[model samples]
Target: MEDNIRNSDRAPLPVGLYPHARKVGGLLFLSGVGPRKKDSKNIPGVELNDKGEIVSYDIETQCKSVFENVRMILEDCGSSWDKLVDVQVFLTNMKDDFSTFNKVYADYFKDIQPCRTTVEINALPTPIAIELKCVAEVSS
Candidate 1:
């Protein structure tokens, strides 16, 4: 006899993406997440740095928000930060802000140490400091 299982009770995400977390066996894969809200075009809590007569940048605040966004996505998928298995972080300025980024990151994944990679890029949409992608597991 073939085993039958049904999972139609999961809540759907509002984004035009996959709804009802897809599960292959015991693993769950989630998509990349940013700091944008449900209806906002630009991410919240991201402020551009303005110098005497020029606008510079702020990396610490942006990095913190990025982590918060990651946490929210994980929660939506029925997973939590402790369940994360892998994480990929993208940054526009890795050299100048890597230390600060790590400082903020430690506060989130203090106990659960997931595999992580950080990459430096040319730029991101607007002045957003960091973007993170993660993979997690849900207990069966």
Candidate 2:
């Protein structure tokens, strides 16, 4: 027999978007999560420097917020970070902010050393300093 797990507790994001949670086999593929607050704009843009240019941004705050957002998504899907199998982090300035970003990121993911990849990008909406995407395993 085949079983599917879907989370209907969380509000629908959009018509075409996937729901907060979906289970296939024993793995759960979570979508990308951002640092935007619940009431903040749907798309929380990047964080910009004082000069209005995308530069080395707030590593601690942005990283923590990103994790919080991920946690929210996981909770909505009836899971947690402990089940994460991999994580992908996108940065606008990896060379400049890698240290600070690592410091904050390590704190949250200290226990789970899920596979991770960091990539430097040209730009993102708003002044977002960082973006994180993850994959998690759901218990049957």
Candidate 3:
């Protein structure tokens, strides 16, 4: 089959012009999924100061939300969490958030341990602290 761009009505809209995922051959590549819920401006664990800057955030909460968001996109694209082959995790703060994020990630990925990479980034398009890019195998 040809490459098909996929989007989920239940997932948060992308910050930029992009679909939720793209299906090519037997693989599904997901765009970066953040912790924002659909139609909501508030991030899951984000706390902003009066100046609209991040004050404090909960990495565990953000991690769980992001994982669920990835799952939503995968399921919407005819895939499942177990089908994930690779995961690229982006975090704004590696020193502070890595341990918490790793714990949460371990819970979700313990059984379905896919190849994973975690990196620190300056920021995402949104105010979210965590985002995930995933690749999953599409069952024929």
How many residue pairs clash per model?
0, 5, 0
Off-target runs (Cα >4 Å) in candidate 1 are 1-22, 48-54
Question: Which stretch of 10 consecutive residues in model 3 shows the poorest summed lDDT?
Answer: 1-10
lDDT tens digits by residue: candidate 3, 1-140: 33488888889999998899999889999999999999988899999888878898998999999998999999988899999999999999999999999988999999999999999999988777999999999865
lDDT, each prediction: 0.63, 0.69, 0.91
Best by lDDT: 3
Which sections of candidate 2 miss by over 4 Å? 1-21, 42-56
Ranking of candidates on TM-score, top first: 3, 2, 1
**Total clashes for model 1:** 0
TM-score of each: 0.71, 0.75, 0.95
Taking all chains together, the TM-score of candidate 3 against the true structure is 0.95
lDDT against true structure, model 1:
0.63
Cα lDDT tens digits, model 2, 3-101, are: 354543433242235555567777776655556565454334345456766544466777877787777777666677798888999887888889999
